[model samples]
Target: MNSNQTEQGIRTLGVDIGGSGVKAIVLDEQGLTITERSRVKTPQPATPEAVLNAIASLASEQGEFERVAVGFPGVVQYGITKTAVNLDPQWENFNLGDALSKLLAKPVKVANDADIQGLGAIKGQGVELVLTLGTGFGSALFIDGKLVPNLEMGHHPFRKGETYEEQLGRAALNKIGVQKWNNRLQRAIANLEHLFNYNTLYLGGGEAKNINFQLPESVVVIPNISGLLGGIKLWQN
Candidate 1:
């Protein structure tokens, strides 16, 4: 592809990097998948270099693509990862976008995983919130389709001086039985509803299926694929 094609972003490789796995898919200009989604186990320790290698391996599996977009499970500011609570500590302050671009020989953009998932799931209407249940809790807020960016609500105190992630993350769920976890999630929903007053709440991530309680009418459970699908929006003007 030429510069114009690259600029237009004819084909985009979308990569979602999480604590447990890294998934990639090729999408056309319309943000529809054009290639089969591929996934690999996230390397143990998940250091920046190890994760980059995993992503690059997936990138090569997909056919020609003009550029790449990545959703990372942490705060990403201008492609620099500011946090990695679930991954190795070495990820902090790393320039993931530049690293991936150099590694893959393609332009790259990166954003917080939940933020990208919100980009894919939001309705672009009123205040919206997205909560991803996985190895850790991830959150994003949007108002009228404009992202608030890096809200990190998961790290905020929720109950008993514990952060939301500490109480709702996969580790927490496993520690507490399913019944207790479900109760906690219910309380969280009520609290979040009062706090954000969002018109919609989207629940996503691989663990979303574990939610056993009846969700409120305004809350919707989105497929895990939204994490990868939302990558296309990172390149949008």
Candidate 2:
């Protein structure tokens, strides 16, 4: 809709790369789309090269996009990953934005996967704490509209020699029954509330969608698929 964003065609597309898959969506200036979104398997090993190649291939199929944004599952420093938890060890110390940008030959932006999803869920709200319940727990703190990157709070010990992610994530959900699961969820929320004082807490990602029990007050459940729209905003900024 304006001069600056016209080059990327993301005025036409936004790509969300998750542990399981890569999602691509086309959007207008208002972040609304004129076409349907697309998704494909996220490469395993989830290494810098494999994921980058997958993104490049996906981008090629969609013709051309104005800009591309990827969500990495790790602690990101200046668009390069300083640490990767659930992904390939090779991902650690990788320059993802630069790598992907070179491959796509376009403007490419990367953020901790959950942060991008979190930003997508807040509908572009400047600041909020987002806890994404996926393969591992993804937590991101957005301060004054900037994503601070990896916060790995999931690995913090909670109980019984298990970390918070182990107690509350999907793997743990199946292992723990409803009563016990909600108990941990409650404690996790309490901890987050105390730590961040985030006015809004958005719970997104695949597992958040299957939440069966009642959520605590002020905790919002956002559609997991909705993150694609948020990815669009990354370039707009």
Candidate 3:
């Protein structure tokens, strides 16, 4: 047991369901990490059932917790998944919160993966935008700490009739090489700055580590860990 476990005696499990993997961590009431985050590769076909099973296995490693907060890679409204993105089309309209809660035997809170990430990364003031670069691009917009969920900015048309993800996602980076990919990111940043005029922009996700250029003062790149680290905040709302 750590200081948080001894002091507060309360903890919650934070789960991040990604396109490539699922990660979970135990966080005390004070928002301190209590366990080394556990991870499992997202199963083949990446259906709701498969991902839920994987998350359950990850949660089991943490023993027990009061509640579960999940950040899923799609549009989530009141625990229902509205979009699938990189996941199976079957995930659409799935009541993930109810299903996961039933499986884990605990209350569950579900939100857009990027929205959950922004909850951790934002300053809770002014206009903020978070972009997650991974198998696909995930985006969340916020103003004064309030989330504007399900923007799905990645699918919108961008350069040469390609969606932002087509030019900037992991597959794009692997296909175009880091230098060109980084250039694309720079341009994307410029475009977003013009479009949203956000006070701050946070870049996260597995591929954020690949950024090689200096970002503008308004831009910040957060660790990939923010994905799971931000999970606790889901219950705060």
Candidate 4:
């Protein structure tokens, strides 16, 4: 590896804060996991302070690390969260990166959870889209490895005047049953294909495993771990 690669290869702490869980892992510069993941239930109410404590606790167990990267289940810009759909309202407008940096005493970078997942999954060749089916639907778009931040496609009207998240998220999957939810997902995929004309689509998040139907050739199912693995990309530049 080159000097830059060697420098980056130092340990990095990657944290993914979701609606239901907070997960952390240590990674090498190349985004390979160097330690087993550490996770805890997201605290009740999941306020900024509560979630911060959870993340900090997990980080504390991760051993020494040079820097930190985070993936949050919301729209994040410049380390500040702009929206929190499934999380507590207090998360909106929170400077999560700054807060975590202070608590962890390490430089931190943060982005939309799906954006991070896409960074770990995309092939850097063409228009790519990632959809995460977890507590609530999340989306990320990319073109030749360049991220289009904060897409928030989940809030867009999909069918029956309901948002995509209403019909596709984990709650929806549970309410509608797996078979029906899978049908809705298939239809949504078709709609998205025409909307973005993306070269590839990656499906992830906790609920992705519930998909029981055949996916289109252009679509691939990615592991939920992609959210944490993609953390390294935040520091690549």
Candidate 3 lDDT (Cα, 0 to 1): 0.89
For model 2, name the residue pairs that clash.
8-65, 8-66, 9-12, 9-66, 10-13, 10-66, 120-230
Each model's C-alpha lDDT? 0.92, 0.74, 0.89, 0.92
Model 4 clash pairs? none
Q: What lDDT is reached at residue 4 by model 2?
A: 46
For residues 56-75, write the lDDT of model 3, one tens digit per residue.
88888987688988999988
- Runs in model 3 lying further than 4 Å from the true structure: 4-7
Best-to-worst order by TM-score is 3, 4, 1, 2
Off by over 4 Å in 4: 1-8
For residues 47-78, what per-residue lDDT tens digits would candidate 4 score against the true structure? 99999999989988988899999999999989
Q: For all the candidates, what are their Cα RMSDs to the real structure?
A: 3.3, 3.6, 1.4, 2.7
